[model samples]
Target: MSERVTPGHSGGLITLGTADALWAGLTNGSAVPTVSAACTCFPADVRAGYVLLGGRVVATVKAGGGQWGVPEMEVRRAAAELNVVKMDHGDLVRIGPFGGAPKQKQNDTAPLRWRQRIARELQELGDVERAAPSEGRLHHLAGIDWRVLVEETRDRTVRAWWLPRAVVRLLDAAEHAETRWLQAARTRQNSTAAAEPPSQRRQIRAAGGRQTTSPHSPTTAPRPYNGELKELLYSALSRKHGISRKVAEWMCAVCRTTPATVLDHCHEHGYVRAPVCQSCNTQERPDHLYSNDIRVASHYTRLFDTHNVDWLRHWHRCPGCRTRTTLPLPHLAAWTAYIACRSLRPTHRAPRGRKPCGVLRVSWTGSQNAPRSCLLTVTVDFCPSGEHRVLAQIPYREAAERFGTWLAETAPAVAAAAGPDRLDGLPTQPRPVIPDTNSDGQALF
Candidate 1:
């Protein structure tokens, strides 16, 4: 046969009912008495009060009105016996008429015991500092004292999750020291840079100080006979003579020479021997003046010698006529012709003959053999040969009148051939006209 268990009964003992029912029965005086039939004899259907015995309940005899009750002395005795049984079994039990049971008292200290067990296990595993409360023990230890756990135990197996104030203070001190060291290093670098010598500093300046200095000017000395000396000489010459300095000097030097002797030498040597003081003549070779005509002729010869035949071809061609046969005279001869032409009257005509003076002669004739109203004469000679003669005879006024007529007739054609004049805005002058009259009394228009 199997043993049967009932409510509020376990391990062959009767246990107390719920706290609410037990308190109601005790206060209302309706307690029921439960007793083991094998142990003690009691009246049938007897009701009694119950009292606490450790974590269990026990029945007592009822008083009036069928109310269960317990005597103070019996209650004390049962309490002492239950205390002993509780210490022996680490719990309490109860016996009733229906069954023997265990106590239903809650074990309030169970969680703290489990917590201690877990902490020991973590320490053995070298992880106590990292251990957290288990789900089963969280509510149990929610209000427990932690002072003893914190003070007595040292968890060298795990690192602390939070930093201590002393370690933080040390870290702050190291950081400050590093910052100060860096500042000192920078200060030293600046001081060394500033201590450089001035010359070295200049070398390090931007672009080596090229911007600060100006370039040096070239060191050339001036030659003599500058503008000032030229102006002074010009003033002196102008004051002393009415001529330019160049002409005056030339005329003075020529005047010193014997004209007759100079003229003779000019024909033979093509130059006039320069006159000199007696002292200079004895000391130096004589200098001479080359004739302008010979100089001009020689210049052309040199030009022809140096240049090709094309240059000479260009020189002979008349730009206006576009004819190579019409040639210009040498520059010196042209200038002499121009001067002679300018000096004579336009009416005068050159004559042709040799006179008694051995020079060529020229005269101009009027309408008849009239004397003052008729003729004018010119004599031509060479300086060295002393040849003087009449060269030509013609009517002076008649020649001029004829030339004017020729000019009028040719001017338009010459002007058109020469293109526009650059300076005078006029055209080139024309060749003069010659007039011829016969025995008939008609004038040649």
Candidate 2:
């Protein structure tokens, strides 16, 4: 089982066994984003070195007696810097949305199943109450009041939730105990290298018989972070936005390897998220959100609205589902409108006693590079044995107006044909159909 980093299991230095396992896994088929010339070698000395990714050092590692270990603090620091999810088992690292299983279906029953599982786990730790779902309410040890929500997409649905700090601690403790139990049950491996004398253990250079010392020796290791300077920076940055002289003392929050120089903030809200290097600050500018891809737009909007806040503190909770989202008021209003428009699609139904046909689906498409040329395409014909038909092609900007007019006219009949609404008002836009037209707007046939 993989140990996830949470508020609970986030303490304690990583064990040698875990680090060794990680190193072996990474060096094999696993694709690490970064590497160094010295990476081919192992265990140069007891002093801590680094695990580099994308040419940047993300985490610090140490070796002793042919064993390796990572400091837990460094893991947390690196995770925040890289914007990638760290896995304690199975996979070494994940860069996308959170999930243990690949392409797992998240349906209506998923939340209930997870709730039961969590409740059972909690019962083992102590008393845990199961109460009615409440949006964004993180109850104390007296009860668990958080709600679990599913965000639907073309490929899958994602579940998001918030947990009380106390519950997280309890769960971490249980996981820790399980880890200890597993360690005790396993037999220890003998390490003859650990008993070897310093002189005998020396590694010889391929160029000559003389042994060469590693360039990344303890003397060359990065200096320790200044806690006092960090506190002062945090306090000062929270009050007003400006470049700090102390930035040289801190690593970039986006890339852990570089020294921070610029204080990055949300352009819309002007709230500081982190101190980042000049390159990251430039590349992640707020203007990138203007792309035609809703995914890209939504991602950047949320990034600016929530990234800094979430990283420095906790997630901003959604008003409806209470899923941890700190989306601003304007974006939230836009989201509500988008959801409403999406829910306008009527349910699909087949003739009585006849085989069922597919439902309506709507989507947007175009070259991401050319946002202005994006189109809103729709498909209507989904008969069992019949070929699909292209219903309409509306410009992206006119999608909502066109959809509203069309729905008002066709909704009653479509509703009557489809029977009652059963999908709980999820957006029902028809999936885009491949058009028969060519670049010149003429039919191919």
Candidate 3:
């Protein structure tokens, strides 16, 4: 008969293959001694307060009641016993880019053992560096040079990873480790649920009936801004235009409903964009390559375009109307009609009928803090084909009067269409029909 295993008993000899089988059995919720047993015979670092199931190290239970997996030394020992070679820089590069996890097929390019090794090493390094352990930190530790791009207008520089292959290797390893941790947590949670009394289990089932959350469900709430992450966000906020913790509590700039709790920035360019919610922040993916597509183009292109444009400025709710009354088609149409009527030239009418100059484009320049007034810029594009020329600059009150008067005259129809408290239109001013070749335009708000 085979030797019976007991807690804290190392007298029973187990082969490497048997140890592997025991580890697999423990992972699959088998009746293993991993929970009760202790590695009293082994060294402190290798033992790490964790009970070795067979001869294999499991996880380290910290004094503070947290688990971070087996120690690095223990992992090295396992690797040596298994005859697994250490992954070098070339091997990491050969792993290639990680384009996110696949839905159907497995995307674990890195081995589980290697991932455990890297994660433990990263955790140890993070303890010394006084920063939270993250997959991105691997690049910094590897002495990999980041590509730095200068932003003259912001008086800042943005840095991004120079190599894609290295990024993939780090991400793959991180993904594998995170996946393993999540699986372990889930298994433990299920076991706890199973141990509960029938009445309690039924109550739990009834209470959780409405809850449709899964491990893959999108996070609804924003991540807590505490510890090292909070400090990092605060440092990044220094370069942003008008973002603060108070401002972040307001409505999201992207989704417009959820509270803006996350400080969003361009990952490729590294410049702060806007205050958005956690969901919006994750959803908005900027193109790493500055492509031609206007909708999903790179943030660098959008920022550069904003600087190059003449009339465009940062858009916000109008104090008078409590809505974005600058760039909607209906507002623009009403404004154009009103401007044409005002600038009508009855004597200079052509055979094809009068085309009163061109359309008048009204956009917000910026708000005056002291006097509490908005600067509305009116640019007129002359008939047929001409550039948008500066027409006039008026206060928020004047612009409100022009747009409101026109709406009141066309009452009921236009008024109802431009719904009350409407927050419509793109976040920026309307793009000029004629592109300004000259790049000497003033900086956007």
- Using all chains and alpha carbons, the TM-scores for the candidates as numbered come to 0.13, 0.25, 0.23
On residues 69-186, what C-alpha lDDT tens digit does candidate 2 reach at each position?
5555543443333334232222111112233323434332121123334433343334223444235332221011122211112225432222422222222222222222222222
Clashing residue pairs in candidate 3, if any?
none
How well does model 2 score by local distance difference test?
0.32
Model 2, stretches more than 4 Å misplaced? 1-26, 29-262, 275-288, 291-330, 337-445
Give the Å shift of residue 404 in candidate 1. Answer: 26
Native-referenced Cα lDDT, model 1:
0.25
lDDT of each: 0.25, 0.32, 0.32
lDDT by residue for model 1 over 1-445, one digit each (tens)?
2222244432222212222232322223211121222111211111212222221223334346744333333333333432232111111111111112223333332211222332333334454345454433321111111211321222473222111222212222222222233333345445545997545432111121211111111112212211121112222333554332222122112113211111101111111122211111111111111111111112232233332132222222223211212112222122222222324312222356422232222333332213246543444544235545443343434433433343234343432333223223111332121232211111111
Candidate 3: list runs displaced more than 4 Å: 1-373, 376-392, 398-445
Candidate scoring better on TM-score of 2 and 3: 2
Ranking of candidates on TM-score, top first: 2, 3, 1
